[model samples]
Target: MDAALADCRACPRLVAWREQVAREKRAAYRDETYWGRPVTGLGPADARLLVVGLAPAAHGGNRTGRMFTGDRSGDVLFAAMYAVGLTNQPTATHRGDGLRLLDTRVTAPVHCAPPDNKPTPDERDRCRHWLVTELGLLAPTVRAIVVLGGWGWQALLPALTSAGWQVPRPRPKFGHGVRYEIAPDGPGRSSLHLFGCYHVSQQNTFTGRLTPAMLEDVFAQAKSAAER
Candidate 1:
C-alpha cells in the first residue's frame, strides 16, 4: 500500500516543490539525499491506534522518507509515544534508526512536503483518496485515532465517513484533548474513538502550546480506548 503511495505524483505543485527542496538542499544536509516523493504511512498492520498528522516537513519526512522522522516535531512526538509505551525508542532521527511503533500507525492528510508547511485545499482534497484507502484497510483493527492538528482532524472526517464510519451531521470541533466516539453503522465493525491533540510542530512545542506530558496524556487516552 505504502509503496504505491510513495510513487504518486498527482499534484504537480507538490511534485515540483518537493524536488526543488531536494535539489536546493539545506546547508546542513547538503550531502544527504532527499526522498522527494510522497511519503507513506508507517506502523503495524494490526494497529489498534491510528495517528493522523497534517503533512511532512520539507527537510523532515521529505528527506528521510518516513513520516515524522528527522525533525524536531518528530523528536517531540516519538518521545511522547515512547513515554506512553507506544514506541520502542524516544526519538525518530531517520527511517532506519531502529525505531518501532507498537499498536499504532502514523499517517498524514498530505503525503508530500508543502511550501511554508501548508497545503492548499485542492491539494488536501486530492490527497484524500490515499487516506481513504488506508483507513478502509485498517478499519477492522483500528479502534481509536489520534488526530494531530486541525488540518488532519478536518481531513479525516470525510474520509472516515467514506470508509463506512457513521459521523454526526454537525461535525465536532477540534480542540486539544477532545474526543468523539463514532459508532459503526454496519454490523461486524468496531466503534471508533477519535482523540484530538495539538500538532507536535516546532511552533507549538517551542511556544509550549503542546508539552510532553500533554501529548502523553492524549496517547494514554488513545491506548485506553484502543484496549476497550
Candidate 2:
C-alpha cells in the first residue's frame, strides 16, 4: 500500500504543486533533498488510534516523507501525544528521527501537498481512495479516530460510512473536543469513536486557539476510548 501510495499521480494539480515546491526548495532546507511525493500513512498496522489531518505541509511531510514530520504543526501534535503517552518523543524533526507512536497511526485525507496549504474538494475526493483503503485495512484494530480540523473531519465521515461504520443520519458537527460514537454494522466488527480537535497549525497554535493542554485533553479521550 505504501509503495502504491508513493507512486500515485491521480491528481494533476496536486502533483504539479508538490513537485514545484520540491524543485524550488525552502531556503532553510535548500541543501536537503525533498520527498515531494505522496506521504504515506505511518505507525503500527494494528493501531487502535487513528489520527487524520488535512494534508501534508509543503515543507513538512512533503519534504520529509512522513506524515506531520518536519513542521511546527507536528511539534505541537507530537508534544501533546507524548504527554498523553502516545509517542516516544515530543518532536518530529525528520522521517528517520526515531520517533514512534504507540497504539496510534497518523494519516491525511490528501496524500500530496497542496498549494497555499489547501486542497480543492475535487482533489480531496480523488485522494479519498487511499484513506479509505487505509481505514479498511486498520478497521479491526482501530477503535477511535482523532480528526484534526474540520477538513479532516469532513473527509473521514464518507470514508467511515463507506467502510461499513454506521454513521448517524443528521451527521455530527465538527468542533474542538467534540466526540461521537458510531456502532459497528454487525457482529465481529469494532465500533468506532470519533474525536475532533483543532488542527495543530501555526494559525491556531500561535494565537492560542489550540493549546498544549487542549490537545492533551483530546488525546486523553482518544487513549481512553482506544483502551476500552
lDDT of 1: 0.93
Clashing pairs in 2: none
1-228 per-residue lDDT for model 2 (tens digits)? 999999999999999999999999999999999999999998999999999999999999999999999999998999999999999989999877899999999999999999999999999999988888898889889999999999999999998887778889898999999999988875546988899999999999999999999999999999999999
Per-model CA lDDT versus the true structure:
0.93, 0.93
Writing each residue's lDDT as its tens digit, candidate 1 over 1-228 gives 888898999999999999999999899999999989999998998899999999999999999999999999999999999998999999898878899999999999899999999999999999999998898888889999999999899999998887888989899899999999997776556899999999999899999999999999999999999989
The regions of model 2 sitting more than 4 angstroms off are 186-188
**Per-model RMSD to reference:** 0.9, 0.9
Candidate 1 Cα misplacement greater than 4 A, ranges: none
